[model samples]
Each structure stands twice: as C-alpha cells, then as structure tokens.
Target chain A: MTGAPMPRLPTGIAWLDRLTHGGIPARRLTVLLGQAGAGKTLLSCQIAAARARVEGAGTVFAALEEPPADIIRNAAGFTWDLAALAGEHFHPLDLRPDPDMVFAGDFDLRGMLATLSAKARQTGAGLVVLDGLDTVLGWLASPARRSAELARIGRWLEEEGLTAIVTAKAERHGGPADALGPLEFAVSLVVALERREESGGTLRALRITKSRGSAHSSSAHPLFFSHNGLEPLMWPGGDAPPASQERVGSGMARLDALLGGGYLRGSTALLSGPPGTGKSTLAALFAASICAGGGRAVHVAFDEGPEQSIRNMRSVGIDLAAHRASGALRLIGLQPGRDGPEQLLSEILAAVETQDATALVVDPVSSLMRGGVADLGQSAVRRLVEEARARGMTAVLTSLVEIGEDPASGTLSAVSTIADAWIALGYAERGGERNRTLSIVKARGSAHSNQTREFVMSSEGCTLADVYTAGGAVLLGTARMEREAEERRLETLAALDHQRRLRALEAQLTEAELRQRRSALESEAARAELALLEAAEAERRAAQAERQARTAASRSADTPAEEGASA
Target chain B: MSAAAVALFVAGGAPRSAAALRNLTAAIAATGRPEGTFRVEVIDVLREPGRALEAGLLATPSLALTAPHGRRRWFVGEFDQPELLAGWLGDVLDGEPP
Candidate 1:
C-alpha cells in the first residue's frame, strides 16, 4: 500500500474531521470503540448518514445489536430523515440473528460476511457499517477465532472496495473485553468516545487512538451529542475567514474606552455576570449598535421568548423592531430543554448566513447547559464564538454566574478562555442599594481599562459611568453618588477653609500696613517737631549771636578788657 | 501404493510459476508410484483462477494430496524446495499398497 494514493472520507463532523485529518481512511475497515452508552451507535449512524447524504455514496448500515427501528428513531431525533435517506439509496439492514437460529447448527463470521456482501451487492453500497460487532463476536467460540474472522472480513471488504465501519464495546469484564479482538489490529483506524462526570455534569470526550497511514489528533477532545448528532466538542480551529483590522462600537463610549475602542471586528467577547446584572442588555446594545450602523446581526435569545426579548430590549430604549423589520436583525428564541444545544447553534449559524450577519449575540449562553451535558454546552458556545469570529462577525456571548461562585472557575470559564475579551458584570451592594458594575477581566490585543465602571441600564440603553473607587472599594450607583457627594462636600469644606485663611492673612496684611502707615506718620510728626525745634534753636542762636555781636561791639568799644574775656 | 489424488497449480504467464510447475512435476514423478496407482492434476490459475480459491490455493505451484486412507495435506512454496516436496509426498504414500 506504500506510495499509493490514500483516499479519505469525511465524517461530516467538523472537529472530528479535523482530528482525523480529513476523516477515516477510505476503503478500509475502521473500528469504533466505546463503552455502553458512549454514543458509538450514534456516531456510526452519523458517519453512515454523512457518507450517504454528503458524499453521494451508497451506504448500507447493518444493525447487529440495536433494532433498526431504534436506530431509525434515534437518527430521526437528530433530524436525519432516515426514510428520506433510504429513498436516496441509503439502506438500513437488521443483521441481528433470529432467536431460533441462535442455537442452530451454525452461525459464524462467514455467514455474516456473506450476508453483508450480498446486501452491499444488492444495494450497490460503497460504504458498510457493521454495528455491534461485539454482539456478533459473542456468537463465536473464542477470541482467536473472532480475530481471524474479523481479519477475513477486513480482506473481503477490501477486495470489494467497500469501506467498512465496525463498532465494538470497550468493556472490562463480564461483557465485551477491552481487547477489541482482531479489530484492534485489523482496522486502519480506531476511534473511541467516552464520558466522565464533572462538577457541572457529564463531559463527553472523543479520541482517535489509531489512524494508520495518516496523521491524526491523539488527544481526547470533548464530545457533544445533540439534535445534530455526535461531534467533538472542540472548535475546528481554522474554519473562520481571515481577520480584518476593523473596530466596531460596543454601544457605550465608556465601555468602548474600557475595551480599547470596542471589541475587534471578528472577535468574540464573553459577558459573564450574575442574573439581572444586565449581561443581556449589554449584548443587546452591542447587537443594536451593529445593526444601527447598517450591518446585520443575529440575537439568539436563550432565556426569553422573541417577543419578551424584543420587549425587554425596547424597555431599555433599544428599538430592534425597525432592524428586525428591515431584515438587519434576527431574533431567535429557543426553549432550553425543547431544542438541544447543537440545534440552537445550527439555527443561529443559519440565521447568521441568512441575514449575512456581522454581529451575533447569544443572550445568556448558560441556557445552553440546560441539557446537562456540560462539555456539550462549553463546546457549542466555543464553536459559536469561533465560527462567528471566523466569518468576520463580532460575537458577544453572555453567561449568568451564580452568586458567591467564583467567576474565574464558573461554568463559563472554559468558554471565557477563547474569547478575545472577557467582560465580567456583577452587582455591587453599597449604601443599601444594588447596582451593576462592569469590569474588563481580560482583553487581548488592546489596552483595556482595569477599573470597574458602573454599568447602568436606562431608558436610553446601557451605558458605563465613570469608574468610582472609594475606601479601596469599587462602588456603583448610590454608593458612587454618595462618594462623589462626599468628595464634593470635602472639596467645598476645604475651599471654605482656604477662603477663611485667605481673609485672615489679608486682615493681617491690612493690620501690618496700618501699623506701617501709623509709624511713618509718627516718624514724620517727630521729624517735623525736631525740625521745628531745630529751627527755633537756630533762631535763638541767631538772636543770641546778634545780641552777643551787639555786646561784643559794645565790649569792643570797651574792648580792651572785654576782648580778653571774649577771647 | 493405494490411489492418491494430487493437484499442482501454476499461473499461466508467470515465469516463476512455469519453473515451479516443472520442478513440482519432477518431484511428483519421483514419488515412485505406479502410473495407475496415483493421479496428478495440473491447473493453470490464470485460465481458471476462480478454482484457486475452491482448492484453498493462495499462490502458484501449491500442491495438495488426498490420500486413499483419508489424509489431506497441503504444501506451498517455490519449486526450489522440490526434494522436500518429494519427501512429503513419499511419507503421504508410505503405507499405501502398490
């Protein structure tokens, strides 16, 4: 088989296809191993349905364990339309042995192979599914014989150029052995589906244990089974289109500032919050913004009916009626338990395509967990977000975090990891009032605000108030108002005190000026008095000198004796 | 020796099958049985390849014997091991009347 071109068939599940590197090898025996209720039957049925419907290949599904009716019913639950599939050349064969023939002389692999070959020939089937091969193995005597027979069956199918899929139980004891008998070595590919318990609910996982002649993912990926069928819960990584360096509004300018000019175009944002914290309102605002900008949007209302959702949004002054009427917005309402998660996702995707949506909002994605398959909900949300991003659409998903639950490890944590931005909304109880707060937990590719802003849902739509932190606590609503009022009061008191000090300083300056003026007047008066005294003294001295001059004259007349005294 | 049945198969146009057929014929002749005591049938799988599966033959120059005493044995390989083939045939016919 070396150097020969290997052909592969798609299993129709996106993540599974990616895991198997396009799909299981064509024209080869593939073994599907799983425990009871691990979804092997459903997976096999999905493959057969895919080959028949998608590839236009004739498929013959031979049911060995479950009755054909049950298989058909299950397929119907996924909306596969098995009857229509049969009309289009898909055949379902009941290969279970008759009760009388169970103890008959002989019933072996040869007989089963011959029957299968005949059926394939009659239906011109290119693909064959042997469901419950372990059930057929039970009729055989020994493991060695079963292995040999399986090897022969593999050869026969190869010789006929028919692709074969066989399902075997992976039980430990009392039932089918874990050893897949010869199928483990005989088949070209081996896939396993498993389920385990988690904190939320059961987590289904799918793994490709063996794929000969092709590379495949070896890690166990979460598996989801819903109305669409079985699929790996992992996002198919590259299905989205290329991203553009475009930015869209998040409806609120302050929120946009918090999100670094709003979420990137073709990016996903996760809004996690407690119930009644305006998560849906934020999503509605995001969607309405896109629609108002003349772009299409899809709003998947999980918690409320369409009318109620529209009414609720309208209450916040987000009128979606115009956009809905103009075909710019699509509102899809799904009752959680009525339709499975996969169905809801598909419908949303369909609406996205139909509306050519540039934005998508799944209001309260937590409702996707209603079916109790935790991994399914997680995977579905992840896929929705990724797909929307890939198509260059902004996707905003909301999740309701319960009170007292850590938002970091809540039900939405797994989904939050893939979001381009995570906006955590919650209520702050301050000043005996409850108000919503919005905080950016993480935003990739942008510098976003770290402060928690007060998220207000008003008649004019949702808006973010200025960040308010008081006493080392982020406050909201009445607490924020109270803090602001207190700040203003303090500022007013400081201003009043500053004015009083200025007046006191001014009075002291006035007092000092008065004292300086008085001292100058006193000094001027003293100088004036001294000058007057000096003047009088000068006049006296002059009078005295004149009088002395007269005396000296007289004395000079009597001079001789007076001159000696004057000298 | 009692009557024994043997068959030799060779692909019609294969060089190895022709050489193997010649070696197998010589080994059968060396079995030392009288002409009428044993019968050797030659089948060309190319001309009648469907018969190969019926005879449980998987390759060219395969030989099988149905001994008169109800023993069945099959030998498969290249004609390069003709002596081993002859020895096996001798043991199969050892107790048969001649």
Candidate 2:
C-alpha cells in the first residue's frame, strides 16, 4: 500500500509502454480499443494475469461476453492461471446472462458503474476489466447522455484508484474518424490492433492510436502472439559491433581520397545527383570495386539491365563482366514489377548471406521505392538501409537528382540521414559550356575537398582534375576555368617584370638615402657642438644651486622648530 | 497395374455412397467414375448437407474437370488419369504414372 509508484513497469512491450508511459500508470481506467476482433478482451486479460504474476496483486477478471466457464477455458489455452492466481489472492467474478431481479428496462450507466465500483471496493482490487462497452453505452439513449456516461465513468474510474480496462468494438470499415468509438476520447490509452491476411499467414500491426499522458510507440510495429502471450516483433535495431573491415577503393583514386580510404566494409552510401550525371555508373563501379578487392558483391539492378549498367560503366572503364567472370561480382537484375519492399529485402538478405558479399549496390533506391518495390514507403528504404548497416556490409545507393538545381543545396530525398557519406555527381553550365563537376557533399568521419572539382570521363578512365577555384569563389564550370588559365599566364609574366622593377627601385632608394643622411649629419654636428657648450654651462650652474638647496634643507632640519625660526 | 486403377477402369452397375469411394475395387465395380459431365465432386446430401450446399454440389456422382481446350477434348472421366489412357498422355506419365 505504501511503496513507490510500482515502477510503472513496461509490461515488457515497448509500444504499449510508450503509450501509457509506464504500464497504464496504475489506478486508472486504461481502456483497450479495437474493432470487434481487435483482441480487446485478450489484451485486458493479459494485463490482469500479468499484473498478478508480476506484482503479486489480488487480480480479478470479469467476463461479460462469454460464460465464466468458457472464458476460463479460453484463458487456459493461454495457460494463464486465472483461477489459481485467484485461489491464492485474486477473485474472478463472472456476471453472465444477468440477474432475474434486475430487468433490462431498469439497467442504466449510473447503476452499472455503481455495481462496478462496489465490486472493486469489495475485492480491494486495483485493476478492473470490462469486456464490452456497447452494453454499457446502451444505457445512454442520446449523444449527450453517451458523453456524460463516458465522462462520468472516466472520472469515477480515476477516483476509485482503479486502472480499469474497458473495451469497445469500434467500426473499422469506416474512416479513422468513424472507426474511433466513444473511449477514443475518454480512455487513457488506445491500441488499435490491425491483423490482415498476408501471403502465408496473418500480419498483425499494433498501432498506439492515442495515449493521454505518455510517449506511445507511434510506428505500426509487427506483433507476435503465442501461448506465452503477446509481444512486438523487434527488427535488428540493438547494439552490434561496427563494421571494421577495410574499404575497397572505388577504382577512382582521387574519389577514394575524398572518401576516407573509400566506403567502409559495411556502410550504405547514397549516390544522388541530377539525371545523366552517372549515378548508376558510379554505383556499378563501386560494386565492381568491391569485387576487385577480393570480396563478393551483388549488384541489384532495379532500373537498368546488366548490359546497360556495364555499357554505362564502360565510359569510366569499369568492366563488370570481367569481375563477374572472375567469380567475384554477382549481378541480380530485378524486374521492377516482380518483388515488394519486404520481398526485395528478403532476397537481398538471402543473396548477401549466401554470396557472403562484402558490398551491395541497390541502383537508384528512388526508383525501387517509387515504382519497383511494393509495400514500402519512403521510410521503408530507411529501414532497409538500417538493416544493411546492422549486417556490416557496404551498400552503395544511388539517386537521380533533377538538373538545373543546385545539388549542393539538394538533400538525398530517400533516406539520407543514415548515409555515412554522399558522393554527389552533378553538371554545371557556364559560358554556354556544360561541364561535369564532382563534389563530396558530406563524408562522415573524413576530411574532404570543399571545392567542386571538374572530372572528365572517357574511354581511357574516370579522372578528377585539379580542384577548380575561380573568381573569388569556387567554380565548377569551364568558362571561369579558361579565364583562370589565361589569368594565371598573365600573372606569371607580370611577376617576372615586377622582380626587375623591384631590383632597379632598390638600387635608387639605397644610394639616395646614404647621400642625404651624410649631408644632414654634417649640418646637424655643428648645431650639436653649440648645444653641448650651452648645456655644459647650464649643468655647472644647476649643480651649484642644488648643493646650496641641500645645505639649506639640512640646516633647516637641524634647527628643528625654534632653531629653524632663528635660521 | 495396381488393383485400384484396374478396378477404376472397369464398368459400374449401381448407385454408391461417397464414404465407400476410397475402396475402389468394390465402388468402381458398382458405379463407374463420377457421372457428372460438367463437374466431378461427389455430394452426400444426407450426411454432409452443409458442405454440399457450401460447395454447390448435387446429390449424385460428380465429375469436376470437364471442358474443351483447343483441338484436344480432354475427356477427364475419372478423378485421376486412366491407366489405358496413359499412352496418349506421353512418356512422362507411364500407364497411370505413379
């Protein structure tokens, strides 16, 4: 009766706890919600039995929908000892079929709540479970009466120091507005259980629809229920060792330098830039780089075929087939319509694990989400990237940014936060000449050149020229670049001519200063001699006066008061 | 040939119950493969009245797979492929192939 607030324990379910802060914040009517088959009664019963098992409370579960015996049988399937727990300390009251004395006509909200409270007080129970809200809501004839009943029940449940779970069957086929019943506003927590038929089995998605005073799990989490009860399916999101393998160079030396010895063994990078900027080419080359480095790499082509990818990379001289033939690179060309987000993930995971790949290239993840993969939103790509990070494999992601916009200002719209680095390849036009500019927008854990460098791709190879710095700013185009070349030539010639001019000026200034100082010294020396003569006379006179003043002072001190007056 | 398929190939004489369909030697000798030319799934309206209505079947012998495709008319008279007709199905299915 007198301990700290029961630790408000996390019912071991993170999402549920997030909704009610800590396990329903004891002594409150925590209504369980859902449509008819929302597993509302199951949720409440689980809480009741869990409370008894965990906190050793005298728990009571009253079933209104089923016969008490049938309810007990169902609970037995879950192997929860409702009667046993009741035998030790708890008591389960089953009010089914109603009493002969009280007719349906006399039943009302006030009467029902009075009976509920009386039962709670009699049992000294802290948790109360109500099976269905419709029977109770029927007591109210109108909307105003319904709201009043809800408000009264909510307030009474709070005052009784009882955390009651009242479930109402919501209308789900309608919109969310219509799906939410009365308790959506009255209850402290609302967990909407969504179970739809998946391919093989049912997929259960638990969403915390509302929580009055807590941080609920907002994401619709995959749920699992077995004989042991309910739980949320946790993705690979816990603590794991960071990928420590050395990165294989992307075959572009300067690019490698910008990438801090290239991408780490298991890291996902997003290649975002305008179309025709070689995002796919760069991605293929990175994959080829991984195979060249002696580890397996899989190139999942969601948009382009192997031939297109290879031909595109050929511009930069990255031969994918040579590496593929060497038993290093595996290219899985995915027909855009075949798989979904989850399916692609499963396939990718299977391929990487089977291939034991050190790197993976998902060409243009934007296309994969926009058109290729079903069942994945923009956020789903983030989850995939997160999964890749957990596996410690390098995943190279590429995105096509629209042209004519400053890529420097553009963010990787598809899952950029988890990107350890972004290698932005863009095109800039200046003086009617279009040029290719490659810049490392952001590279985590590495120092990179800030200047937008010009890169030329040809049959020879992909190469990055000297960094382009132009006209009081960093330029990435050809016009200012040409102007800079001409200006450099002019500056070189001007520097040589200035050297000659400086030498001639130094000779003239040196001779002029020496001759001028000699003439001034002669004129100033005579004036110095005259000034010294006057100064010598003044010094002798001042010394004599100082000697006299000292003597007068000493004689005055010797005379004291009367002697000083006589002096 | 196995006794089951051999029995299925013979002619039948009378009406039979579905529970006895598993004992092919006696069931097929009495009643040939289901007589429903359109659909061939048996219905025992007496015992499984619920299931019969659910599956939309009549209270008699039924043949489920029946129809025409291209130039070939697949006269699927039996519940399974026939032993004598196996030769027409090709080398893949040898005499009511196992």
Candidate 3:
C-alpha cells in the first residue's frame, strides 16, 4: 500500500527492473532456484558483470561449480565482459569446491562462506551470489546439513542488509520445514528458470515462484537464451497504437471482388490452406499490389527466406525483388518461429516503424505455430495481428491447413476468431492439370463476391481471372472436394467398365495380405525359427515350432533332407 | 555501463541483473537513508513492465516511484533502478501520488 520501507531494492539486472515491480528487496537475500539451463547463470552473471558501475555497493559472483573458463564461456553468451569488471568494481570469487572434493565427505561450506564473507566485506560489496546452491549442497555430508547451511546463509545476508542471491538447481528441494528448499519455504524471494518447448523450439521462462518481503511483479517472463545470455521478452503490445490509416485493396481483382471491395488498410485477413495452395504467391501478389498502389509493404517470412520467396514469386510474375529495390517492398526472412510471440511482435513493430510500412504479410502464420509452444502461440499470433491492426497496417497472415486439420484443429479456429476476413485457397484439377483457386469465405462490413476465383501464377506473376459459380461448394476445404471430384470422375469411367475396379480391389487386397504374411513369416524366422518349412506340413506345425526349427537348422544339420522335403 | 550495453545485457536474461539494479537503488538510498526523510519502494520490471505501466509509466528506463503528496515532484528516466528510485522517493510521502 504505502511505498516500500526498505532502503532501496537493488535489482541485479537493470533492464529487468525496467520490466519488474521495482527491484528485489534491498535487505533480504533472494534465492533464484531454477532448472538447469533456466538461465540462472545468465541472470547472475548480468548482476555480477554490472557491478563495475553499480556504485556504492559492490557485487561479487562466487562461482563454485563452474570453472572460471566455463563461467567465462557462459558469461560471453550473455555478451558480458566479466574481465572488464575487475578492480573498477566487479569481483568474481572462484570458490569452486575442488571437483574431486565436491563429492568427498569432508566438504566445508562454512569455510567457503567465511572466505566469501571476507571477500565481500573487503570489497564493501552489498550484493553476493553463490553461483548456485546445488553444487555446494551436494558437497554437504547430509541433506540436513545442506538445509542448515542455506538457512544460515539466508539469515546472514538478510540481517547484514547485503542483498544476496543463491542460485540453486531446480529439483525436489526442501519443504516448509526450515528456511531452505524450493517454493514451499520462506525465502525473501524465489526465481525459477525453466526451459519450455514452445512453437517447436525451446522457450526460456522466468517464473517468480515466490517473492515474500514486498509486493512483486507476478508475471512469468517469456525468455530466450541468446548470444548475450538470458533475455526477457518485451510485451506484445505495440509501442503506441497507430491511428487508423487509409483504405487499401488486396490488388488481386478476382480475390478483391470476393472480399467485397478490398481489404481495409490495417485490417487483418487470414489465408488458410494446404501446400500448393499458393499461400506464399498470394501473399507476394498482395505485397506487389500494395507497392503498385503507392504504399510500402514488408514481408517477414518464416517458411522461406527472402531469396527463395522472391524467386518463387517471380515465377508467378511478381518480382518482389524489384519492388524491394524500388523501396516499395521490404522483405525480411525470419527463422521459423525463432523467437517467442512477444519477441516476434516486437520485431514486426520495429521493422514496420523503421520501414514506414503501410502493409505487412507474415507468410504462413503456421510458422509461428511450429515451435513447441502450442497454446501460447495462438494468443501470441492473435496479439501480433492485433498489433498490426493497431499500427494501422493491413496484416495478411497465411496459415497451412492439412486437409484433415481444416475442420477440427483449434489453431486455425483460434486464428479465425481474430481475423477480419477469411480466405481459403486450394488446388483443384479441372482437366488433367491442377489449378489454384482463391475463395473468400467472410469479410466483415463488405460485400464479398460469392464465388471462387481462378488464380494463376505463370512466368509473369499472380493473375486473378474468372470466378467459378459452380465449383461444387466453396467450403469443402480442399482435400474432401478434390477427393469427391476424383470419385465422380472414376465413377463415370467405371460406368463403362465395372469389372476393372473389382479386379483392382481383389488384386490389391490379395497383394496386401500376401505382403503381411510374408513379413510376419520372415520376422518369425529371424527371431527364432531354424527348421526349413515343409509346405505340406507347415500348416499343421504351429508358428512357434516352425521358428525354432528354422533358427536351429540355419546353424547346424546341413539337413538337405529337411529342406528338400519343404521344397 | 553504457545504457545501451546494460540494456542489451539485461535483456539477455541475467537474473542477477535485478540484484545489480537493487543495489544501485539501495546504494543511493543509503546515501539518503541516514536522514530517514523518505523510503523508496522499488520493483524490478524487467520481467513484467506491465507493472511499470500500471504505475502509469509509458516508457521503460523511466521511474514512477514518487509521490511528493502535492508539494514536490518526481520525474522518470534513467538506467539505474535504485538511484532513479530515490529521486522519486523524495517526492513520495511528500506529494500526491504519481
């Protein structure tokens, strides 16, 4: 309620404090207990590395488990020059319990503490971090001893007003018994780093397991391990929502007619379909149209890079590279969901502002879905669309829908909820060749042509021609419709010759059964069969007997009689 | 540390990065603590700047932990969490909430 009464909360990381409540409690020692690879070292190093200029209170990093070289390597990943912190104010105390002694029974943490305390006191350091507690605790003769040591360390740091943090491995730690263990105990603060599979990639997560002394920021920051170290993700919200901008057309005549007039500038349209549906080509053509209409467009690709996308679009007669060179189109190829949703959102916003983009396309929002993060991605993508809309830029997102997934999967459904318009694209065989069709399913507040438009990409570029009034029904979602059409064609052909399909089915079934029988027989022989099978008696002898004889005969009893009888 | 360098570094995911910010505030608060004129409440917003925004901060690297009751004032913008928090504490408990 009232302002925090502590002297001042010194956040180990300044940039983190910029996103946190204020800082960790100034008088209490917090424990950042997390899983391995949760970025504990990264977080601690940032604090340790910042001390050279932290002012008044010096900081010491007591790295006991990791050798100085490994520490340096890890710090380097965070882009920190730990060596530069020496003397000017930063100090790294290499208190590594001997690697050999780490497992020995005679490990004394109190002595290590004494040395650390002396070093901290001498430097007038206010912040101290035991690079982690697990390494040191494992040195303890017993879990009880380990627990006692942490409790003592916690009390000393809290009483001395030396803001401290002891990094610990996140496993089954202690309980509410004393001042030790994981989240169940009473620590001034607790931070957990967890690596979660997200969008098919690993997401670095920083969860505030607990923060006791004062009110704290209670959000889990989506984090990433980068060349520099553990970085917190920015918020998904755009810097400042862009005021509504002008109206803009998608530029594909048939596609535009389907969507009433054209897409609203800043509105979000979702394009969903399977491969060969021309998702990328459609996006490229829209981008080209925007460029031709006197506005800039940016394409941030995840499926393919700029070169491939440019080349492919050129095959369709849309020369994106030209537009790029002319300054009307800016294409940035991003690695597949290489970043979390928030990070991706920031990158888009940053790119848009830097390029003064009036329109943007993310070709295959499905790329955002591939990273192992299932639930968060949908929200993140939706937020991205919202951000694009807020920035007053038309956002056209392409999604890959497996024929089976179109009707049921929650991904596109979630995306559909956020889209201002829905367009379905697919390949349909008219003669003996496949042609692409772009159908607009919904467009809010606009009169969309109730027709599926023929879209083609040849040596020139994407072209929208005639609309098909009787393409069966537009919402068959591609695969089913194609399969049904193929069935009808086959039926017509079969009407002329009924026996062809029957013979085909019988032969196919016989071939399949024979294949299964042969495979099963071969595997059984490989497993234990030794005797050669006598075709006449094979049916009488069970499969088990056949296997044993086969396996045994293969090794011994040149037994040409057994083989001859089987033949 | 250069502000940009610190930012890029903290954004890297250093948990201790917050400790450094806290010590910064405490150190400056220590300079002013002897007088016991005002207390500072600091929140590390590195993982949750939404909290910073809730406090009405539009830009990060900006501080809002000040009050001044009505008499004095607080301004936000700095790379240091502690040192910056003090400038605001001087306003808090003395003026209207920021």
Clashes of each: 4, 14, 87
Interface RMSD of 1: 14.5
Cα misplacement distance, residue B34 of candidate 2 (Å): 40
Q: Return the candidate ranking by TM-score, descending.
A: 1, 3, 2
Model 1 lDDT on a 0 to 1 scale: 0.74
lDDT of 1 by residue, A11-77 (tens): 7656667777787778788888878888888887777777666777777888777888888787785
Tell me the deviation in Å of residue A23 in model 2.
20
lDDT of 2 at A336: 48
Model 3: per-residue Cα lDDT at residue A62: 75
Residues B1-98 of candidate 3: C-alpha lDDT, one tens digit per residue: 11101111121133443544554457445546444343444544444433432332212222223223332232323334454444434434434242
Q: Residues A1-567, candidate 3, lDDT per residue (tens digit)?
A: 346554546564554655445566675667776666767776877766654445434676777678656776656634457666655456676655332210211222333444555566667777877776566555445556656666766666766667777787766431121224433343567776777654356666676766664555656667644333565444422343543434577867756656666787678989888888888777887899999888888898985789988878777678788899999988988776566654565566667777888898998787765655675577567656765666678889998888666444667788877788888887777545676777778776677775676666678556666542345643332444565677789998878678787889999999999999999999988665445445546666676566668766787866534533543
lDDT at position B56, candidate 2: 26
Task: Give the poorly placed runs of model 1, Cα more than 4 Å off.
Answer: A1-6, A102-115, A173-180, A195-202, A214-218, A236-243, A252-261, A272-278, A293-296, A301-304, A325-358, A366-383, A399-416, A424-441, A447-567, B1-98
List DockQ for all candidates: 0.02, 0.01, 0.02
DockQ-based CAPRI category assigned to the predicted complex of candidate 1: incorrect
lDDT (C-alpha) at residue A265 in model 1 = 94
Candidate 3, A430: how far from true, in Å? 9.4
Ranked by DockQ, the better of candidates 1 and 3 is 1
List of chain B TM-scores, one per candidate: 0.77, 0.27, 0.37
